[model samples]
Structure formats: structure tokens, C-alpha cells
Target: MKSGFPSTSPFRLPPWAIRLARRQQNSMAGAADRMRFVIQLALTNVTAQTGGPFGAAVFETKTGRLIAIGVNVVEPTNCSLAHAEVVALANAHANLKQFDLSAPGMPKLTLVTSCEPCAMCYGAILWSGVRNVVCAARGSDAAAIGFDEAPKPKNWVATLEDRGISVTRDLCRDEAIAAFQRYQQTDGRIYNARKGLT
Candidate 1:
């Protein structure tokens, strides 16, 4: 909504938008449970169109809905990987102030974006003392994510896994698009990314 313009936060979507997001990722069963919990008390809501070059949508998971705090859509034309990384941190910091993370009943912040958060962003999240992060976008089809200016194979899930966050890749990557379409039903596709949700 909001003309799909770049803003600190997107317009509070109507019930239909929520339904649409759910339907779009319906095949994702785990997401259903996760979404149910995150949607309950969304003090804030945002969506990031950061799926291109160096952009990301940050989400803070709450009781029943994920709060879209800030988006890191830094373009390569304007900056480098290093600059993008700093921007991510600043976005997260500003988000904390908006939600008053220090207050009681503060909703858990979940960064839902198009790409894996760079190392600096990860550090900022850790420093912010928020743990619930959900990255909604997929990585580049050809390149792996890295902290360095130049990406390398060494920077994969291992980097985050070693930090203790349970890593789960969506079925979108390995599973073919047709395979993804096969599990569709009225409510949507039966999404089962590594099982655990009904």
C-alpha cells in the first residue's frame, strides 16, 4: 500500500493484505504457526521491497504478527557492501527507538527482509538484544552472502549457525517451482519447510 513508496514504515495493510501475505506463502506450514504468533500484537508493521541488489526488509516478530521496522534498500550505485551494512545497523537502531524496546510487553523484533542480513546488521540485532529475526527473502541465485566486499563460499549458514540461531532454509531454493505449486489447496499450498508444522 502507500503507493508502494519507500518509507520508514508502510501503511497498515487491510485484512485482505494480511490474508494475501498468508496465501502467498501458504504452502509454508511453519510460517502459519509463526505468523499466528507474530500477528497478535504488532505495535508496528512494515514491508521492505529490498529484494534487489542490496536491499532487505527487517522484521521484528511479536506475539501474533511480525513488525516491519525498517528496510535496508541501499543501492549499489549509491554505496558499497560496507555502506549497506552500516545502513542496516542504523535502521535497526532507529526501529528500537520507535518501538521502545525497553518498555515492558515490548514486542519481539523480527527482521523480515528479502536477503540475509549482513554481518553488521547481525551484530546490531545481537547488540540490540533482540533474537526473533525472520528473513523473508531468498539469497542471490548465483552468489552466496558474505560480510566482505567480495562474497565467497565460506560465508554461508554456518556463519549464523555458529552464532546459535537455528537455521532453516525455505523449500523455495531446492524445490522446483512446479513442486512448490503441487501442494496447493483452498487455504493455499501446504508449505512444509523441514516439517514440524501441521
Candidate 2:
């Protein structure tokens, strides 16, 4: 297989998402600034019918330079692994041409997501090598709309910090929740919603 090419079919952010990312690149500088952009991405994904109502990005923690952006593409790509945080981290690694984002000479990286990560993405954050995570909205907010975040240890945040990753939650809280509301209004699919976890 070609280097950096998935052995299977490749999926990507929609054209509109790409265009918007280009337009907004370098326009944000802090956790709050970044959260606004991510929430917009989630809401826009709903409006554009591109993906689920979740958005994430990787940025240089210092420069705040946008590294990569992701909106959930699970349904469209038919890939369960295409959660917003996973896509953003994968794209960030691709842009840096490396799997370990914390490699020497690399600037510190922060992953900003419109909502707190689900169980799968919590693991992804550990492996992604980003130094920090900033989230808007909580798992409960997603569950309110019938999406399951699955099981995460109550100590998940503390665990990340124990591993050298800092966690910041609830940035631009109301606005992020608004993205989920928009998704609900648009009848967005809660693909992970299960009838029973039992």
C-alpha cells in the first residue's frame, strides 16, 4: 500500500469543511477561541448533512496554528472508527508525517473538541500524543440526545493528566450544547445510541 494511505477505502472531511477550515485557519489562539471554531464545525456538519454533530481539531499549543480539523464522518464513510477526535488526530499525524505527535522538535499539540470524548476517543487521546485536550459540552449532553458515550472510568480526566496530558473541560459550554441542539433539530443520527448496554 502507498505510504500514509489506508489499506482500505479512504474517507475525508467534506469539501465545505475543507474550505471553511482554510478560511478560519490561524484565526484562533486559546481554548475558548478554539472551542468556538469546533462548535461551528459541528453545527455546520449538521446543516451540510455531512456527518454527526461533533467536531475536533489539533493545534500547536503555543502558536495556536491549526493543524487539522475533523467532523464525524462515521455514517457517510461507513466507518465506525471515524469519530471526530480520531479523525482529527489521524489527520494531524498525517500532516506532521509522523505517528507520534510529541516527537522531538515538534511543538506541543492540543486537541480541541466540541464535546467531551466518548469511551473510544478517550483511549485515542492517550495514543494521539497531544499534550493537552480542551472540550466543550459533556458526555451527559450527548446522552440527553440519545447518543451513548459508552463507559468511561470516572477518573478518566485525572488519568490523562497522570500521563502528561492536561484536560480542560466546558469551554464555551452553552454554545457547544447548541451544536447538539442543532443536530437534534436537523434529526441527526445518533449512530452509537444502543437500545441496551445490558
* TM-scores of all predicted structures: 0.41, 0.92
Instruction: Write model 1 residue lDDT over 29-71, tens digit each, in one string.
Output: 2543443222221211122222122322234344333223222
The digit string of per-residue lDDT tens for model 2 on 31-118 reads 7888888888888999999999899988888878888888899998899889899988888877777789998888899999999999
Model 1: per-residue Cα lDDT at residue 66: 29
- Model 2 misses residue 112 by how many Å? 0.2
For candidate 2, list the clashing residue pairs, or say none: none
Off by over 4 Å in 2: 1-10, 196-198
- lDDT of all predictions, in order shown? 0.34, 0.84
Counted clashes in each candidate structure: 22, 0
* Model 2 per-residue lDDT at 183: 88
Which model scores highest in TM-score? 2
**Root-mean-square deviation of candidate 1:** 12.4
